[model samples]
Target: MAEQRMPLPPLLLDGAEYHADPIRRALSALAGDRAGRFAPGDLAAAMGSDYTMTVTPGRASVPAPADGTGGVYLVESAAPVTLAVTPPHATRDRIDRLVAYVVPAQAGGTPGAWYLAVREGEPAASPVPPAVGAALVLYDLWVHSAASGRPIELSDMRLSGGQQMLAGGTLAGAERPATAPAGTVWTSTTTRQSWAYSGTAWRLLGVQDDTLASHALSGSRAWGPGVNEQAVDNLTFGPGRNGGLIELSAGVVHLSRPGRWALSMQAFSDDGTPGSSKVWLDWPGGPWLTRDLCDTRMRGGGFAGAGVLHQPISWTGVVTSDQALNAITIRGAFTPSTGGNRPSYMVWLYVDYLGR
Candidate 1:
């Protein structure tokens, strides 16, 4: 359908003759058909044409409104608000979409209102051909980036077509189909799961679950009795095989997002009078807190088993911080009951990441 018009209101004011309702002229371009509205600039850039859009009492609005029979339809506003939209079917897609937004009204001017309309559906082909572009949204959620149009089909949530799907006879017997095609898949006799074919072979259309079950170890480092030190360990700890997120030198870790993080450590120390090892939280430029890990038991008898002692310690704590762009430093120190002995070495530091 084309743009349609509504009856114009009489140009009169409070008990006297006057100009048109300032609201009506502001939205003069809108009508029942060609219900679409746009600013002069958007139309020029997108379609190389000059156009203005207006609305009726049911369409004029202040805050942008959603399209439908419901919601607050724009009847009037305090200002003349402008809106812009790209022509529908600008790219090759099964359906076209119309989008609009309201611009803030001009300062120190008569307040105006506009029609709020958003649309998406299969419509008549456009008079103008699709524009050349790098990417275009095909269906509601489908996307294509190449200029060359190729069919990459998604079969029952599994993707196939020019790429990877295959068919190995998995059904009952000779009566069963031989190969799974591009867009259609068949159930397997073995696993009984649906499979689709690409250029290569048939692949499964299913979900998978991967668990983080293994323990990743960090290389050990030593600490003295009276001086502050970093319990250096292998920094190979992060998402999958990418490596860890924490720094071994500065002991700083730049977080991807803020959430709950748990750190657990099992350590061993050399012979000494034996004392507690302290672990501190360093948010770098933020707050600092310490956790005292107990010395547990002291065992010795070296120098042919004379003064040799070993103390086992465990440290665990939870940290909650803000999202990205924040950094953390974990600091540690060992306090010996007596001086002159290298009392500690961090053996293992296990980290667990959890969401809030």
Candidate 2:
């Protein structure tokens, strides 16, 4: 009878001729299937300490896989072992490779096995390092041509991994990766923002704070009870803060990104009068027509004359523009009578961005 070559689940038949090859192949294939679940360079957690190296001391510590278990293949070291590295080349640069390799069994008592070694490479401007068949490259030691006594620096080594979900450090807008696998996250140090790739494009993550367009009161200017005008202030722009999506001018906040925004304000009035003070927000030509007028009235006799009255009001609504620009106008006035009266006033307007 021809013997089965590939591995399969072991099964027995009554009074059937039995051999060791089929059983061994089945068990080995099962184990290989399990090991394949992990990436090529994944370090087995329970096996031993992660393959770590000390550059200055030129030492390396590696954990051997127990019996049949290993990162990619079994290792020869019976237990955790350390290896000393040879000194760097005096006149040429090279890469020292730490690798785990498998050796097939020989004809004698020698058995198939796995072993770890630090293979030194030929020195050159860009040297091609040696590689064993199916070996797991644990780390790369970049040795530059240096004086004989110089210590190895941290910048001269790199730990190898099967994959990286995150890049080493925060990146700038220009430094952001041009292409990344889906689900990879890139953070920006300059904007303190992050984006996640979705296989097609990068999308912003987390809440974005609204721009502080303006916050001030029309000082020294008294209104005629119902006097209202555009809230004005000296505009200051933060470099690259809003990505030009929002801008602040004399008294108007420009919203170039179409989305919902929470509009809020506080108005104050005190003019030896006994009436109510009011403030309201509006974006005349945009989707958000008007916000509720907030009012504050003097409480009692002691608070009637020359007493300050301030009230805060807020509204969350959507603003849209086909041209990607919307100008929000913040207006304030003192309406003492049910009709109209005049007085000095203070108004504070705040705009916060809410997502689409």
Per-residue lDDT for 1-356 in model 1, tens only?
89966465444535654433344334432321122212211111121222222222212222222321111212333333333323334345332222223322442233343323323344333322222121111112121222425322211211111211222223442222554434345653432335454434444343221232222344445655456467453344434522232223344444432344455555544543444455443444322243233333434333323334333333333343332234544445555555555444545446544434
TM-score for each candidate, following the candidate numbering: 0.31, 0.33
Question: Listing every candidate in turn, what is its Cα RMSD in Å to the true structure after a full C-alpha superposition?
Answer: 24.2, 16.0
Per-residue lDDT, model 1, residue 257, is: 29
User: What would the per-residue lDDT of candidate 2 be over residues 1-356, giving only the tens digit for each residue?
Assistant: 88777544335766666654355445435334222212212332111123245321211222223342333332223345465566667787777776655544432244555555678778887866665345555556665676544443322122344322222223456456886655567866654556676556555555444443223322234556346443534333334343323545665676655567666666666665445545565555665333334444552123346556666777776765442254665555543433445565565655556677
Flag clash pairs in model 2: 225-341, 225-342, 272-306
**What CA RMSD would candidate 1 show?**
24.2
Local distance difference test scores for all models:
0.35, 0.49
Task: Give candidate 2 regions above 4 Å deviation.
Answer: 1-230, 233-245, 289-306, 335-341
Q: Where is the poorest 10-residue window by lDDT in model 2?
A: 55-64
lDDT of 1 at 338: 53
> Candidate 2 at residue 322, lDDT?
42
Which regions of candidate 1 deviate over 4 angstroms? 1-215, 223-251, 272-330
